[model samples]
Target: MPHKRRVYFISDRTGLTVEALGSSLITQFDIVEFQRITLPFIDTVDKAREALAEVNQAHIDTGQRPLVFSSIVDDAVRAEINKANGLVLDVFERFIVPLESELGQKSLHLLGKSHSAGNVKDYNHRIEAINYTLSHDDGVTHRALDEADIILVGVSRSGKTPTCLYMAMQFGIKAANYPLIPEDLEANRIPPSLLPHKAKVWGLSITPDRLHQIRKERRPDSTYAALDNCRYEVAAAEKLMRQTGIPFLDSTTKSIEEIATHMLHEAHLVRRVY
Candidate 1:
């Protein structure tokens, strides 16, 4: 068994960047098991001291030095955190000096610049996109198809709703999703309402076994969840998408992030939020 180590992601803001970077790097070393903790909004010297105490305590408890990944921009706060009984990896200190040398200028050393609170316009755009996606879910309305950045067409539970919401919340993309119902599958044609916006339509397909497993959880012992029915619907949906020349992706193997990103890339949709 691999020895477990305590890990800390410390930042002056939400600590999202530190957590993401640390988690990604830690995953490369499969031999070590990591216990992760995030200390966000550690901008002040007092907060930094508190974080240091926690890190030290973890190291004492585990008898191993806790790995600290810090994105704290403040010099005083970063200095205090460095007093902890662990290896402190300061992201800004490590990169900013080199960047300053290359650019022949010093960095602003600002806090919360990456995901700042002052960006009201971008925040509002994300909220609007999320609202639009919620209201337009499952072909509930074709009234505003023209306003959608992209339209996702898929059979039920083929991972449409979550992908649309993720795109809206994360990228400020007005995503709309519609289900390919039994009638549509049987007809082997795209819905008439989607015909005008066919150019923006993307299809999501999944393996029958996976779809069957998902459906069974919602409607146990029903024909809707049967493996044979799932196979038929998927095949019909794929054929319809091919005949109409619409781009499609399999959702069985892709995460929600991957699905949303792939659709954005394929559809050439501009992200309003960074």
Candidate 2:
């Protein structure tokens, strides 16, 4: 087996951009293992220096030259990073330099400017969608019943949380999820809270053996994570979804991006890319 090089993704703004670009970058190097460390909104020069020192320490400790993939927007901030010991790859510097040359104009760096803000209606729609998502997030399991644009129900570790978060983040969709508890299974009825929202309910199903393997890692030796239990919950939950006329997706072999995209397409929801 070939050894995987450790690559660190650093950002002094929202780490979302760094993560998104890094995922694309890693696809080009299929054999390399990636270790991600996100440093978001370290905007000041002092903070930038501290961040660079830390990166150098990590490179020395690991005895490996770490690849720094960054999107530090401020020129002074980026300058501090370039002084570090390891190899640094700056996305803005790489792209902007060539664009400046081609356009035959000096490129001015403006760090905090946003070009587009949608109309009032679109702005209100996003605000409402975000409010719904936050109010129905993972902690308040029951609120998912009332406010979701779509409710995804499944057995534990069937990828409920990640799918819901992705829908909210990628699209401006307010997504909620519920785990099919043992009591709900025994009753053989979809929870009453979800009945009124039947039209918007969605389901996710996973193979029992695969779910069992996933759960085992979390709470090993418990019957809750057993193969038999997973099979029963999955079968019952899926049946409930279908019987209630809820449309669903099998999340067994799909990546998080693929699953979110499929659901968005099926639901006719538009992705509000930032």
Candidate 3:
């Protein structure tokens, strides 16, 4: 049996960065199991000491040193956390020094810099894009298709809605998604509402088996969720996309992030947010 090590991600704000970095590093050591804990908003000395106590307790319980990944910017708080009976890896301590040296300047050591709302314009854009995506989901309305940066078209449950929302939230892209219904599939053509913005359209395809499984979870034993219906829908949708020369991608094996990123690259759309 593999020994499970305790892992902590402590941050001055939301511990997203530390968690992302820690998870990435931990995955490289496949032989070891990890029990993850996140301690966010540890900006004060008292909070830091509390976090240290938790880390020490984990170490005592496990009879092994826990791994601590900290992103605290305050020197005093960071020092307090370093006193824990575990291995402390501070992200800012490791990289900020090199960045300061390279830039020949001191770092601001600011908190909440990673996901700050300091850029009002960018923040507003992201909010607007998210609202737009929500309103336009599943071909609910084609009223504002002209304002969309990208339009995703695919058969039902082909991973379109999530991909659209991800692009909107992560990249500040105005994304709209439309489902290709059986009527449009039978006609072997694109939707009339999307025809005006055909250049902004991208298609997503998934294997019929995968689609069948997904639909079955929503409506088991129904004709809509039947394997044969999934096969026909996918085949017709793919054929229509091919006949129209629309660029498409398979969503079966790709994550929503990968799909949105590839769509951005293929469409040559610039991301408004990082």
Candidate 4:
């Protein structure tokens, strides 16, 4: 078994920034295994010391020093964290000074600034987008189809719903998705309702084997889950998308994040939320 190293993500606020940054770097070291824990809202010296104790305990237990990735803005709290018996990677200290020097100004060094809900307008936009996505899911309604920033057309379980949801939550884009049913596939055309907004439509297709596996997990032994049906649906859906000149992606191997980001990039859609 590979030895698992301990990693701590520490922050003064939600700890999301530190966790994301640390996790991204950790993923680069595929050969090494990591056990990560996040300690959020460590705003006081006492809390920082408490977190340091946890780090120290992990190091003692594992006979290896834990790597600490911290995003604490307060100097005193951050200083306390530095006393841990591990190598500390300070996220703010890593770039803030050089950024300040380049911009010829000092940083405000405020806590929770990275992801705070200070911008009520942007926050509201994200919430509204999420609501819109939920309502329009699975072609539930076409009343406000024009309001959608992007619409996804795909076979069932081809990864439309999650991709739409992620785009709404992360980028604040109002996404709507519709599944290609047997009628639409046999007709070899997108739904009539979707055709009106074809300019904003994107497609997601999966390989026959992948679609079969996914469907079998949902409704085993049914025709919907059968390999032969999955093959027919995939081929017909791809052909429909191609004939309509709607750009499509193979979602079999792509992560939801990758698909959403790729759609945003290809369509040149602006991100309303960061």
Error of 1 at 209 (Å): 1.1
Root-mean-square deviation of candidate 1: 1.6
**TM-score list, all predictions:** 0.95, 0.65, 0.95, 0.97
The lowest-lDDT stretch of 10 consecutive residues in candidate 4 is: 109-118
How far residue 28's Cα lies from its native spot in candidate 2, in Å, is 4.8
Question: lDDT, candidate 3, residue 204?
Answer: 98
Q: Candidate 4: misplaced stretches above 4 Å?
A: 1-3
lDDT of 2 by residue, 1-274 (tens): 5334556676765666767787687788876676667777778899898888888877777666677788777888899988877778888888988999999997777664431253666567667776776667543657545656787777778887888877776677888776767777778776677778877777788999899999999999999899998888888888877777778888989999898888888887778764
Q: Where is model 1 more than 4 Å wrong at Cα?
A: 1-3
> For model 3, where is the 10-residue window of minimal lDDT?
109-118
Across residues 187-261, which tens digit of lDDT does each residue of candidate 3 receive?
A: 999899899999999999999999999999999999999999999999999999999988999999998989999
Q: Which lDDT values do the candidates have, in the order given?
A: 0.91, 0.77, 0.93, 0.92
The collision pairs in model 4 are none
Question: In model 3, which regions exceed 4 Å deviation?
Answer: 1-3
- Residue 61 local lDDT, model 4: 86
Alpha-carbon deviation at 117 in model 4, angstroms: 0.6
**lDDT value, candidate 3, whole model:** 0.93
